[model samples]
Target: MGPAQKPNVCRQLSRRALGFFSRDAGVVQRTNLGILRALVCQESTKFKNVWTTHSKSPIAYERGRIYFDNYRCCVSSVASEPRKLYEMPKCSKSEKIEDALLWECPVGEILPNPSDYKSSLIALTAHNWLFRISATTGKVLEKIYLASYCKFRYLSWDTPQEVIAVKSAQNKGSVLARQAGIQQPVLLYLAVFHVLPFSLIGILEINKKIFGNVTDATLSHGILIVMYSSGLVRLYSFQAITEQFMQQKLDLGCACRWGGTAGTVGEAPFGIPCNIKITDTPPLLFEVSSLENAFQIGGHPWHYIITPNKKKQKGVFHICALKDNSLNENLPTVTASGRVVKRTFNLLDDDPEQETFKIVDYEDELGLLSVVAVTQIDAEGKAHLDFHCNEYGTLLKSIPLVESWDVTYSHEVYFDRDLVLHIEQKPSRVFSCYVYQMVCDPGEEETTNRSCEKETNLNIILNSDNHSSDC
Candidate 1:
C-alpha cells in the first residue's frame, strides 16, 4: 500500500448540502420540530387565557386568548371554567386561527420532571380544583381532588425549552398537599412565563457576553424554584414531575404567596417526538461538566471534542478555582514546555492575605476557558454544586455528556476521549500549543495506584504535570 488512497476507515466528515443549517460556519443539528412546537405552544397562546371550552368562546374572543390548534404552541392552558371548554360555540373551518392541534391532549394530569434547570412550575386554580397544569409529560401521572377549588399556572421566563415556569394560586381553599408522595392525573403544559424578576433579566442583559449561553429557564417535566441573588442562583429541583408543583402554589385571593407579583398563563404544550420516524434505538451520548466561569466568568468560553467512536467520551472541561484571597505559590519551576504555569499557590512572607496568585488570562496567548466543578449531594440527597469562587476548589474534567439539537430533527451520535493525555510541546515551534483533556479521579487514586506510565505509550504523555494530584 504505497501513498495511495485506501478504503475509508473513519466516519466520513460531513459534506453538507452547501446551505444546510445555521448560517454560521459551525453547525446546528436543527430540530425544526422543536422550533415548530415552540412557535405553536410558547408564543401563540394569549398571556392571560387558559381555557379552551366552547362556552368560553365569547370570553376568549373578548380576551384575544384563542388560536388555531395548528398554531400548536408547545404549551397548553391550565384550568378554566367548566362551561369554558364548552362555552365557545364550535366555529366553521374558515374561522380557525391556530394551525395544527397535532393531537388534542387527552383529559389527564401532567407530571413534570425537573431537570437541573427550573423550566416548569404548576399551580392550582380558583374553585379549589386542580386548574393549572404544566409539566414535561402532558400525560396523566396522578389524580387530583376535584373539590380543591384552586388553580395553578406554570411560568416560563428564563429558560430555553419553553419558559421559566412558576405555579400560582387563584381562588382560595385547601392548600396544596405536602405529603411525601401523592398522585394527580393531569395534562402536560409545556411552556409558561409569568412576569420575571427584573433582577434576573437585568443580570442576563448586563452580562450577555458571558451568559449568552448560560442556562436559560425552560419548560421541564419537573418542579423547580430559582433563587437568584447575592451572586448565587440556587435551584430546588424535584425528581418527580409532581414532586413539588403543589408545594409552591399560591394562596387564595390570587395574592401571590410565593414571593413576587410575577405570574403568567400557559404558553404551549409539549408533544411526543413523532414516534413514527424516530427509531427506538438510542443515539450515542457524552456527559461532561464545565464551570460557567473558569478563568473568567464572562470571559473566553471553552471547547470540547467528541471524536467519531463508540464510547462517546468527552474531552477535557477545564475549570479554575479562584478564591477571594489570592494563592501564594511555591518557587515555580519551568516545565520542559519552556512555559511556567504554576500549581501550588505561593504566599508573600509578611502579609498572608496578600499572596501571589496566577493572573489567569494575563498572557496574550492564554485566553479564558471553561472551569471544573464538584457537586457534593448533601445528606438530603440535594446535590449542591459549588458556585463559589472562594476557598479550595477542584478543577475537574469529566466525559460522556450528551446534548441534543432541537433545531434539527435528525438524531446523531457523539463520542470523545476521556481527558487525561497531553502532547508535550516540543522545540518544534516557538509557542507550541499542547492540546489534551485531563482526567482527575481523586477518589480512585489511593486504591488504584495507577501510574500515567502504565496508561500511555507516548513519552510526552507522562510529563511532570500529568501526575495523580496535579494535572
Candidate 2:
C-alpha cells in the first residue's frame, strides 16, 4: 500500500478532553469499546502524589539520594527531610566564570559517576570545562579544560571509566562561520574523557559541511547513532572511535593534541586540515525521508525517527529494527532493517508551532513509552506526561504537570518503575514525586453486599435516634 493510503495504527484523543475520564477507562474505551463487560470490570490505575520537596537549586535523584547542583542530599521515602551529604566549593570569581556556583552555571550538564554514583559526580559547563566533584565531601576532585570556542550540549557514559560529550549544533561560532564566507566545515566535536584519573582521551571531529548539521546523536549498544538535518542517519562503531582516539592520544603524548601537534591544530587555525583519523571502518548510513527527530530506547533494538506532517499537524513515527549480527564484529557496521511500521499521532495540542515533544522513558514489559509534551501559552510553561503504547501508538494516559512560567529554565522528569520524580525551576526549585497505583472498584457481588450492610446500619442508627428522642 502507498504511504498515503496506509491506515493510522494509533489514534489519540485530545489531551484536554481525555483528562475527564479515568486513566485506564480511556485506554480500554479507545482500544476495545466492544467489550463493555470487560471495560466495566477492569480496575483503573492512576498516579497519586506521594511527596514534594523544595530545593535552593536544581536537583537530580538517583537511588535514594537527591543530588542538588552542588551537593548530594540523602532523603528517605518514610521521611521527607533531606540530610545534606556534602556541599561543593564555590567557583572563584577570578576565573571570570559565568556562574560562580555549579548549580546556577549556564548551559551545564551534570551526571553521576558511572562506577560509583554515590561517591562522585561530573559537571560540564558551557565554557568547555569539566569538573569532577566528590559526592561525599562536595570537593572538586579533578578539573580539565576541554576546548575553546566549543559549546557542549549532551553527555553520556560509554563505560564505567569513559564518558562521551557532544557539541551543540547551534553553536554561534559555527553559525557565524557559515555566514561569513569562511566555510570551515563546521566541525562537530565529540570528546572522550576518562573518569577515574580525569583526563581527556581524545577528540573526534566530523566535517559537518560534508555531511549535514547534527540534529541528534545517541550511543546505544556500543554503536554511535547520529541523525543529521539532511535526513541522514549514520551508525558508527563507538569502540572503533575510542580506539582511534586512544592511539592518537598515545602518539601525541597529550590529551588535547591533534595529528602530533602541540595544540588542537584543527581548531587553532580554522579550516586547517588535520591528520587525525576518525575510524578505519566506514559508518553504516541510512537516508530517511523527512527525518526531524530520532532517538532509541536504551537496550532496545528499535530506532525511532519522527517526521512532521505540517499540513495535518501530526508527527509520524518510523520504527526501524536493528540487525542482530550488525554490532557483533570488532569494527561494527550496524544497519537498520526496513521500516517496521509507521505510527501517527497529533502534534502537541494540534498546534505545529507552539509545542514540543520528547520521549522520556520506555517500559519494556508493558510496551509503553512516556513522552513529555511541553507547551507555552502566553509565556507560561505547561506540560503533560503522556504514556503511549509503542506498538500501536495508543495513548494510555495523560497527566498534567505543575505549570511554571520560567521559560528560561527547563524542567526534568525521571521515571522509576511505578514512581515518577519531577524537578522544575521557576525562581527556586521544586521536586515532586508521584506513584502509579491501582484504584480498585468493587465487583458486582461485593457492591451488593456492601449496600445491604450499609442499609442495615442505617436502620439501626434511625432506631437508636428515635428512641433517644422519645426518652
Candidate 3:
C-alpha cells in the first residue's frame, strides 16, 4: 500500500486480527486502538454546552449536586437536569438578635466534609460563620463563629486530622479596634478549626511587621505557604503549628503569633518585580499565588504565581519547583530549583487592544499526571480553557468554553472528567451555573468533500487533454 493508504489498510488488518483473538484480547486491542486514535486526533477536541442554571449565590458542585446560598441555603441535584433537592430553614427575625448566632449569611466558600464527602458539606459564610450542613437534607448540623467583622479571603483544608484553615484580615481602624486606640496596621488572622465536631483549634496571628500583608496563602502536604504583599513567601510546618496549638489550648481565645517558633521552615522572596498595572477597583497589591503538591518532579513540590499585566493584557506565570532539604535541618527547607516564566499569550506579534486576558482559575492535577489546566477570560468575555505541559509550560490543548462578558459579574470554573462546571456570580446577588461537555470534533466530512471535488476536476482536465491529442 502507498503511504496515504497504509493507515486504512492497517485499520482493516487490525479489525480482522481482533476477530482472531479471544474476547478478552479483542477488548484490549479495541482499547489500544481507541487510545491510538485519540493521540492521532488530539487537535479535534471541542466543548459543547450541556446545561445552564441560575442561582442567587455562588455555586459549588460535588458529585451530582450543586450547592448554593440564597434566602435559604440549598442544594440542587444536577444528575440529569438541575432541580432543587432541599433548602435550609431561613433565620427568623427574632433569631437575628445581637446575642443569637445565625448561619444566614451568603456563603463565600463551600468545601466537602473530608470524612464524609458525599453526604455532608462545610460552608464558610461572608460573615465569618462556618457551618457543617447535611448535603441531602440541607440541615445545619453545627456552626461556629470564626471572628466578628473579619474579611475572609482564603479557605483550605489540610492533613493530620483534616484541620480547616481560614485566612482573614481585620482593619485596625475598625469600630472596635479604633475605640480601643489600637493604631497598628491591619491584623491578618489564620484560623484553624476541626469540622468533625465543629470546634476552634487555634488562630495564627501573622505579624505584619515581619511578614507584611498576606496576599495569598495555601496548604499542601503538611506545608503552609504564605505569600505577602512585600514579595516575601514563607513556608511553615503544619505539624509544628499543631504542636503549638496543642500547647496553647488553654489560651485559645488569644491569637498565637506566627513565625519565630511557630513552624518557620524556610523563607524566600518571590523574585519577580511587581511592575504590572492592575485594573481592579481599589487596585490589588500583588498577584495571586497557587501552591501545588507536585511530587512528579523528583517527588518535590511545585508552586506557581500568576501575575496579570493589565497594560499588556498578559498573564506571566512564575513556576518554581521546591526541593526538600529537611535532612540537614530539623525542619524541611524549601529551596526553589529555578523560576520559569510562562506568558499566557505571545507578546512579539499579539495586539493587546484586541484581547485583554486574565486568568480566572487554574488547577494542577498531580494525581492524574496531567499538567495545569488554566481558565482564562478575554476582554470580549470568552473563556479560553487550555492545558499546559508541566515542565516547560508549553501549550498542550485548548478546550473552547462558551461565555459572554458582563462587567457586573465574576466567574469560577471546575473541571471534572469530561464536564466543565462554570459558576458566574453577579452583582445583584445572583449566580449562574453552566455545564459544558468536552468532546472530539471529527472534521472528516469536510475533508472528504474537498478531496472528491479535487479528484473530479483533475480527471476532467486529463480527459480534455487526451481529446485534444486524439483530434
Better of 1 and 3 by TM-score: 3
Candidate 1 regions exceeding 4 Å error are 1-150, 155-166, 170-223, 228-231, 240-471
For 263-380, candidate 2 gives per-residue lDDT tens digits of 5322323212223344334455443434344443343555444443233523444344444323322322332422244434444465533767744777553445788887778657
Q: TM-score for all predictions?
A: 0.18, 0.50, 0.50
Model 1, range 332-428, lDDT digits (tens) per residue?
4654434445554434465322322211211111111222222222321111111111122222212211111121121111111111111111232
Q: Scored by CA lDDT, what does every candidate get?
A: 0.23, 0.47, 0.47
Q: Please give the RMSD to the true structure for each candidate, in Å.
A: 27.7, 17.1, 18.2
Q: Is candidate 1 or candidate 2 better by TM-score?
A: 2
In model 3, which regions exceed 4 Å deviation? Answer: 1-48, 70-77, 92-118, 126-129, 145-154, 175-182, 195-200, 207-228, 241-346, 349-409, 425-430, 437-471
lDDT of 1: 0.23
Descending-TM-score candidate ranking: 3, 2, 1
Range of the 10 consecutive residues with the lowest summed lDDT in candidate 1: 197-206
